[model samples]
Target: MQTTSTYKILVVDDDPDIVELLHYNLTKEGYEVEQAENGKKAIDTAVAFKPDVILMDVMMPVLDGIAACRQLREMPEFRQTHIIFLTARAEEFSEVAAFEAGADDFITKPIKPRALLSRLAAYARRDAQQEGLDEVIEIAGLRIDRTSYAVYKGDEKIILPKKEFELLAFLAAKPNKVFSRDELLNNVWGTDVYVIARTVDVHIRKVREKIGEEYIRTIKGVGYKFNTD
Candidate 1:
């Protein structure tokens, strides 16, 4: 994840060996990293460290990652912070629990360092883009103010998650221009991140629901476009 020092990462796990391994690797990759032995410590360290991402384990001594994730999501400061459950649990139920706890991503244990770095890079890219959006775009009655990171449908404001907002902004940047799934994934999700094309459709659906069904047009056999008419 060769990132700048400005981007911090907090690794939470009860195993000393795992913590050392992750700490050493993340530091070697140029990211400022911190560690917590359990979920309780994870929350404290996260608040003080103000990390950009958190790699947490499902099982810990004091508290579990699922519970920690849920608590962090309730805090406004951690709402957009990317939390990835890096645990050995691979069961379907475990995956469900992780998402239900407000996890942004999940990874099974025994992952290679390079693969882990790739996954984290996707999040860093998305975060950077969200913070960098500076233009205020208005199409028809919909207003996107990048400065405040807010969207307005006429006088009514709409709140969207990081991904949904990014997808909406990308299409609205050039209204009526068609962009294929691959193009959207590359531009919004980052080309380095390997996400399925269907992910775009999911985000598009959410954006349409929040902003209005008439704002985004899905072109069959192609991709999607932002529409004002």
Candidate 2:
């Protein structure tokens, strides 16, 4: 039900020109846009603006994007927010760090406005679909709540970033069914988003780290399945 005009976007970059460029383009697309010059300012702005999507550069004054993302992920309010790293850094380790810090997507920047707009539109569509799902999966002392995006192991609460939570919930929902990396990508990340197969591995490992490794089993030559037993 939410349109592009209703989606709030926070664009963070130390480069004045890049910030201005994105602000101009995003506003022209009908999104409510805000800008921050650095990661510290980004957090302050996000607290006030509460943007649904954040487009942040990796290197910035005071705090870097990875640290800012980690700090944001620690807050319950930003748990479901889409944090996409828009940076020039294309190194594998940088990408890994961004994901570890809870980024939903990573874009290497020459700043392709059209591609960026397409991705944002994909996010909007995904958000609308997710809003219709309100179910809980409880098995093996783990409780996955789609409504509140909360997970619990026994009585202790576990906070998972949006992607990791969705991965876990997807596997658990179909307990004992094996899902290939590609299948998980299409179902969880959606066909509109381009993510590498290894991203699925990264998310699965993070989920296991939080919820315990016992629930999800790697099927040697195949993919992964929830261990109901």
User: Top TM-score: which candidate number?
Assistant: 2
Tens digit of per-residue lDDT, candidate 2, span 19-128: 88899999999999999988999999999999999999999989999999999999899998999998898888888888889999999888889989999998888777
Total clashes, candidate 2?
A: 0
**Candidate 1: tens digits of C-alpha lDDT, residues 1-229:** 3246667999998888888888888899888999999999999999999998899999888889999998997786886677888889887678767765766666887867888888887777666666666578887787897755579987787766555777888899889999999999888867666545666776787677777899889899998999866
Consecutive 10-residue window with the lowest summed lDDT within model 2: 126-135
CA lDDT of each candidate? 0.81, 0.90
Runs of candidate 1 exceeding 4 Å displacement:
1-3, 14-16, 37-41, 58-74, 87-106, 118-134
* Residue 219 Cα positional deviation in candidate 2, in Å, after optimal superposition: 1.4
Model 1 TM-score on a 0 to 1 scale: 0.75
What shift in Å separates residue 82 of candidate 2 from its native position after superposition? 0.3
